[model samples]
Target: MLNTYAIMMVLTLIVITIVISLVTRKFNSSTANFYLAGRKVGMLTNSTAICGDYFSAASFLGVAAAVYASGVDGMWYAIGFGAAFVPVVLFLASPLRKFGEYTIPDFLFARFGRSHVARIIGVVMVQLICIFYLAPQMVGAGNTWNVLVGVGFLGMSPYQTGVVAVVIIMMFYVAVGGMKGTTLNQMIQFWVLFTAMFIVFALILINGIGSYASERVPLVNPATMTVEKLMAGEEGSRPYDQAQAVMSPEAFAEVEAAVQQGDPAASVNVVLPQTNKLHPERTMTFQEPGHRYDWLNQFSMVLALVLGTMGLPHIMNRYYTNPSGKSARLTTLWVLGFIGFFYIMSSVAGMGGRKYVSELSGSDPAIADLTVDGLLLKSDQIMPVLGKLLFGEFGLGYVAAGAFAAMFSTVGGLLIASAASWGHDIYENYVNPKAPEWKKVLVGKIAVVVMGLFSLLVGIGIPAIGLDKAYPSLIAMMVTWAFAISGGAFVPMLLCSIWWKRTTRNGAIAGMLVGGGGSILFIGLNILKETGVFPAGSFGAALGSLAFPSIFIIPLSFAVIVLVSLFGRQGQPPYVNSIWARIHGTDALSERVRLAMQEAESRGRA
Candidate 1:
């Protein structure tokens, strides 16, 4: 039941988006244009679009939900996401663009002896990572739709409607306009999401979310029921924690007085130090970190995000859109700025939602079922619920549109990535090498539809399979798993392929098998453990600690690739010298490398 005003806004956005895609349709005459925008994209535009593609539902909704639910522990996602680009800038961006292929598989095949074996392995890995990444965006879209529209469409639930709606809409644009259209849409979507977030952030600050005091700020324990006082020397030290201690008027008064007086020995029972408008006895602070992660999990999660950037298929594909290696390098600088600002705003929105919901629960205990610890029942609902509570229906509409924009922009990029891998890499290279440009484009469009449908089906099954309930924040958890797999499987091999000439096709294949397969197995086992299929014993606990497996899986992958390469005794490709010059040398050198690659392809080596 969307109101008239909200429906109009959403429909208006859809119409405008379709128009933009149609206008960009002429740019898809060849595989190069359809796949990489003819490598002519400028710096700022590509940078913004890359941000759009990189900031999926995980960044839009999951990050805020995480902060709302877990406090400072949540901001680690923002930090790691932004920090990921550092490695990209230093090692991958320029080399990837200079190598200049439609997809990662294309680059791998050309770099590793022009073997279809390497390309096939890359295609499989890309599909796995993209689909895993895509499902969360779909889930986030569904959650936003449930809040904004909350109506069934054509016998579909709100979540189902969202999944189908986004897939179809995004597929239309991607299949019709290809890389150029998707890039334009991503750029526009990023601006829309950023502006809407800024408005919400400003409104929350203006409305005084940080100005009130709370006497009972809720808290949760991640492991066992272990509670400790926030202050160093409280009266009752055993279990008189902040949340429980605030219930005692005599104890609370003494603590509150000492805090108010700013005594040197007085300790504050707060995590973030923000005013809790809902209750007078409790306050929020930003200093807490162990709410959701232990030391090992924290380090592993950061490792996954930091290294995963080099391996994300949709993200890496954007570098190919830049005109040159240098342009790609420059684009990353702008991306860093854009992503940093977005994450900062994400923290604001999360805390604002926490404050708002706490205020609501303070006024009425009946709303407690709708929330947990002053956050939504489903953590992903934080931003959407805040939209209506903070600014009414119009604000809800605006943020909901932004949510969909985040989904559409990322899904469009993913669809294009799948298309490039399937159409250019598999179809043209294997199934139909003599296919015409039009045929190849047609195949790509078909791939988009197929992949979109497949992703939609997977998204629809998330709630039924209990993934939404098993994970704290569905989008973040799923996205992190995708990152773990990417970091484990692709990063090591990619780095070796570019920086080390001894990398062989067999070694790359072995790494993917051992590292990627092991990560998937561990993730599956963790999910089973989380879903109660296995008892939580000491061994189970240790397995749970391996939730973020990239810390171990990555090193294993690097070891396998290196060990196999050293022993395989396969000589480097004939074009390795030119490839090296292209990756590390000038655009002139890149041109010569491209000519050499073409000569290889003409000789059937590619």
Candidate 2:
């Protein structure tokens, strides 16, 4: 069976992960090693590791799926994801590394006059973002397994089995390996996923099924498309016309049967006509905006992703592992290059899906169920499905394994981030300040298990709540939610803390509350509206239309920080000058001095 080859590839990745964890266990004897790999990572290695951390299922599967399903609108996900690192490299990477902390909260606590309030808030935000981000990766895991393995273990559905399997493996490896093990695993995993993406694109080009120039044409026409308009029985609607054009009679019959049943929850894959949300009367096409977002959301989405990278706890934590600020900057440059190439290939793969996947319709009943005309019903399944269609079982196996690699690498970083925040930021500081090193490491490992389980629940609950159906590409949507939250809550506060010496503790806390709190409120309401808890024309639905809240929230946060600092009775921290010096100071000079002293000592000893 095809599942045999895919399962073998996935199993090999797991085995390698476990081996790396076991081999690197000894390096995790101290909190520094466990949390930050002793803060000695080089530029190139750390860049790759950061890439592994940054490119979650959202980038690997979601980006391509977005492109495949939404056409030009989907390409924004790739652009946003790739462009995010620009802000990270320019503003945050060097200074953050130079400040030298184990986690984001540690940086916050130190920067804000050792304020416990700031640290606690930072920890809460980090955990929240990690959970939100982790859920999508878990969803990717389940979806991949459902498509590739097509079976379940121990009475669980195939999706549930995938979720449980990935969580268990992540908990074990992350708990045992610590940052050193995670770093090594992430490095290898990044290359594997990257190679898989490149090969898939290459195959698409080789098969003559894809071309760069063809991306501009409309994927489906509005005139004959059978979407919500057709289902609603509007005047002049021909529901089966578009489906009939591309589908065999057998496939068309199944679609008609599903539509005729009139089950509200049931769905049949059918090409939907695109509308220009920005300009209602204008025509929609593959090359224009409006398939997914209007004018407002187009800008909001970009702002969320660009600013959000600076606020991501796992990503900022990787900067600490760099030996110096300069090295951190260099690492980010490498990351930009690596992810840039990856996103380009992902866009190509998405195009390939649009071009080739429809041909498989009606060839197999099961495959037909997943497609409408030529587009996949669940777009997230594009990578693995495209692989199978391209190179038989071997391509499926390789791409499926790459999907697992993307999840594992990202989930590992998130777990480590979660562990560091809970164990180092909270437990070490407040719970047991004098606790021994062993206890600290043990607690961190425990945190990893707990967070892993939480993510598992979220993953399973997504399908249960009908979220998977509500969104065209759920993984990318959820990831953007996480980005909005992180950007709104942390970016403004971090920018003020690092760049503005006048930022007060109260101001920082207020900014976080407004930015982060506002994001959660808007996103939560959006989810409810999407899920039909808030019916159309309701007040909640009106407010939920602001899908990406970062545009408003980020500026509001910065404004709040400035206003609070200006009006509040409390002034800037007394040691603000020292903190500024440290943040902006050159770590390169000290690193060179240390190296020179070591060289002199070695010569004298010889």
Candidate achieving the largest TM-score? 2
TM-score to true structure, per model: 0.87, 0.92
Best by lDDT: 2
Off by over 4 Å in 1: 208-218, 221-286, 361-369, 372-374, 538-544, 604-606
* lDDT of each residue in 1-606, candidate 1, tens digit only: 364556776777788789888998899888999999999999999999998898899998999888777777788888888789999999999988888778889888878778788889889999999888998998998888877777778999988998888888988989988898899888988887888788778888788656322333444422111122244455655333433443445434544565457454444332222333223355444435665566777888999999988899999999999988889999999998888888888888887776787676444343344553444667787776677667767777788878878888889988999888999999999899999999988999899999999999999998888788677777988898999988987999889888988887788888887777888888888888887776768576557656788888999999999899999857368667877887778877887878877876788854
Positional deviation of residue 315's Cα in model 1 after best superposition, in angstroms: 0.8
lDDT of 2 by residue, 1-606 (tens): 237788898899999999999999999999999999999888999999999998899999999998887777788888999999998888899988878778888877877767888899989999999999999999999999898877889999999989999999999999999999999999999988998888798998887754434555644521222334446654445565644564557657767787687675564565546667876786666666788788788999989988898999889999999888999999999999998999999988987787688766456555665666556778899998888888877888889999999999999999999999999999998999889999999999999999999999999899999888778889999999999999998999888888888889889999999999999999999899888899999998999988899889999999999999989947467767666777886895544443554466469668
Indicate the residue-level lDDT of 414 in model 2.
98
- Where model 2 places Cα greater than 4 Å from the true spot, the runs are 209-212, 215-250, 258-269, 361-366, 569-571, 588-606
Question: lDDT score, residue 75, model 1?
Answer: 82
- Cα error, candidate 1, residue 184 (Å): 1.0
The total number of steric clashes, by the backbone 3 Å criterion, in model 1 comes to: 16
